[model samples]
Target: MDTTILIVDDSQFIVDGLAAILSRKGYSPIMAHGGDECLRILKSAIPDLILLDIMMEPMDGWETLEKIKGDPDTREIPVLMFSAKKITPAEAKEHSLSIDDFVSKPVNPAQLIESIQRIFSRRNDIKEELLLAEGKGVDPSLIKEYGALRKSIEVDRNLLVVLRSAVGRDQAGRTPSPDEMAAVRALEEKVASSERRIRELQELLARTAPPAGQQE
Candidate 1:
């Protein structure tokens, strides 16, 4: 594979061992002695994955991970941390840190490979979701551009129903003023606008789709 992995650890022996194993597995391994160097290297290159050791001094793996996720540029890169301290995914989630995987220190090669495969597998699942969405007669662009449009339409339609009920009478059973009727009309227009946009997007997707029998 053309995957590049970055190994960050204060221990030279650990870094070297992980690097050798990754290289033998057909991955390009980049080494950084500590969190500082890791950030410096990231300024120039973003690796496909990061294997971080949690026992570094001053700026430990958790700190490094926080910095990486805080920055929009590197937040999406998957991070896997290993240490003898036994960090679990549930524990990581409690701290609001997004760790892709965790492995125990004195790492077993088989387990390490399994963790990496799991991370890649999750990514593949996301791609499959997007493909399925596109297959359901929706434009990929509309999926992003109008991402919350459907939910928003649902909410507005519900409001329209409530407003219509209020138009004929109030909570005390009195006739609604002209302003209440105007409010109902406004909500009706909003619902129509969303429905019109959805039709336009569906039409656009149909036009852009390849003709029948054409190979992608």
Candidate 2:
């Protein structure tokens, strides 16, 4: 399963630009034109993440976010809010809502991608730490496991390169074939599963490790 992302905004340009960027990066991007459209799409399928724009005609991003957070089914999907309006930390805190990150308008592609990557990377780290905390002891075999995990990450990075290439080709006015899309999707799933496995191994290692105050 590719990491599916939903993009919500009234601007066709933004939706197309983001879709192109994510598609090239091996993520499957779905678009919704407005708050109503977004909600409607959510009724059918849930995305792994959402990129929401704050300004729009009729219902705005803030209102859409509230609705999403209010609904149990959609609430868990991480949202990265984007806006031309300046956002303050206090405003974000006052919302009492789930916002994984915030991005500014006239979106910087590099910054946007970096932010998303950071969010997922941190999530993987936290998951690994939690797994370790729950373990009885660190596994001596974990060193080997770690090596294998690193190899998997390397493979994923290679796949990302392929995705980037495909995106570059598409940007030159060439459309990607179904086979290319399938390949990208497979790579995305592989990366996600590898990360999960790595976290589990990390937990096992943590559980088996000797306490700091204990002798070897």
Candidate 3:
């Protein structure tokens, strides 16, 4: 299947040009006029990658990037910033934004293709590395620590969803039943305890796990 790409730009010209280039390269490009539209599109389905313009009105590229990266659901989607602004290596280093690559505006088709290919290549490399590590039998302490942390994160995410749903129900004059409220409270306590356990497991792993180059 062709990889889906979401293109966010204020300029129709740039959007059209990018869509044409991506289509020619065998990618499926979906266009959004601005950051709000981009987010609305994401509500239905996330694209494989995002090509974000940095100079849109109302919500510029940087702000949009921040919003995307801040949300856990969207943070993993690779973002390539398409910008006319010259970004110094030092400036890019200082920025906390998780931009995968930057493509200069008046986009060069060759460079864009190369950048996208590199991103996918790097992703494959990481996947291979993870598989290799798993196959080698990761340290038991490390596994325990990671498993605990993952569980805690899942619990926290669930808590957020429940809280949001409860608020929505309340606003709709259909507040949660007493049993549901009690269940939510119990879940909150469980999440807190799980978080504490995860922290302890992390500390134990730090103390017991072998340092680099050490054997079991």
Best by TM-score: 3
Ranking of predictions according to TM-score = 3, 2, 1
lDDT of each: 0.73, 0.73, 0.71
Per-residue lDDT over 25-89 for candidate 3, one digit per residue giving the tens place of the 0 to 100 score? 99999999999999888888799999999889999888888888888889889888777765432
After superposition, the stretches of candidate 3 with alpha carbons farther than 4 Å from their true spots are 88-91, 94-97, 139-216
Error of 1 at 160 (Å): 45
TM-score of 3: 0.63
Candidate 1 C-alpha lDDT tens digits along 1-216: 489999999999999999999988888999999999999999999999999888898799888988988899898898887888643323332432366666777899988988787777766665664465576645567765453454446445544543454455435667767766566666677679878996776567555655456546
Clashing pairs in 2: 132-203, 137-207, 137-208, 138-205, 138-207, 138-208, 138-209
- TM-score for all models, in order of appearance: 0.61, 0.61, 0.63
Q: Clashing residue pairs, candidate 1?
A: none
lDDT of candidate 2 vs native?
0.73
lDDT of 3: 0.71
